[model samples]
Target: METFDETDRRILSVLQREADIALEELGARVGLSRNACWRRVRALETRGVITGRVALLDPAKLGFGLMVFIQVHAARHDAEWLEKFGRAVREMPEILGVYRMTGDLDYLIRARVADVADYDKLYQRLIRKVELNDVSASFVMEELKDALALPL
Candidate 1:
């Protein structure tokens, strides 16, 4: 792990809150010249501190109002089967995230869809594509808190 200095932490905090802040303003806030600030930002990027910036979208507004978590258990553990399942998951737009878990479930998938019918279609498609011994799903009733910001 890389140790971050006060300036780096300040830069990261400011950037996380306001990514569109002007370089001059960011430098002023961080007590550095524009050139120095730019260099630090560049170094941070080179070191993989800043991965990539993206616009977070609203799922409900995009017609995906239902959020569901699906637990998948494969019929058998094999390299080929796991590869195929992973590929299928990558091609699925509704699948927001897929993880290889360490519990009873082999894979945990987060999906968003329009309705129950949409979920049914997605479930059928997934089952048809992968050889699953068991599949269980849980629909999210309410999202109390969902934030991407990591505590630094």
Candidate 2:
């Protein structure tokens, strides 16, 4: 595991929220020279601490206003079933996140669509790809807090 000092934490915290901030600006915020900041960021990237940066877009503006969390029970608890499920989800662009779970649920999927009709199409496409024992979905009424930044 990589150990982080106070300055490293500050740098990471700032980067997490604003990846596009100028190196000099970031250095100013974190109390370091621009070159020093660049060196630290390089080291962090080299150590696999800083991953690729991306723009977080508004789903509503993109016509993907509805968010749904899907609970799935696998047809079979086997490698074949897992591979098929993984492939199906990976191929579907609307599927944002898929997680193998513990307890009653076999897997959890988070996705975005236009509305009920759009979600139905996504469901139809998913079922056609792989067999599922059970599936249920819950639509998000309001997003109180949606974040990608990890706490430093």
Q: What lDDT would each prediction earn against the true structure? A: 0.92, 0.96
TM-score on alpha carbons, each prediction: 0.91, 0.97
Off by over 4 Å in 2: none
Clashes of 1: 0
Residue pairs clashing, model 2? none
Residues 28-129, candidate 1: write the lDDT tens digits: 999999999999999999999999777778999999999999998888899999899988899899999999899888889999999999999999998888
Q: Give the Å shift of residue 30 in candidate 2.
A: 0.9
lDDT of 2 by residue, 1-152 (tens): 77899989999999999999999999999999999999999999998999789999999999999999999999999999899999999999999999999999999999999998999999999999999999999999999999888978
Global CA lDDT of candidate 1, please? 0.92
Best by lDDT: 2
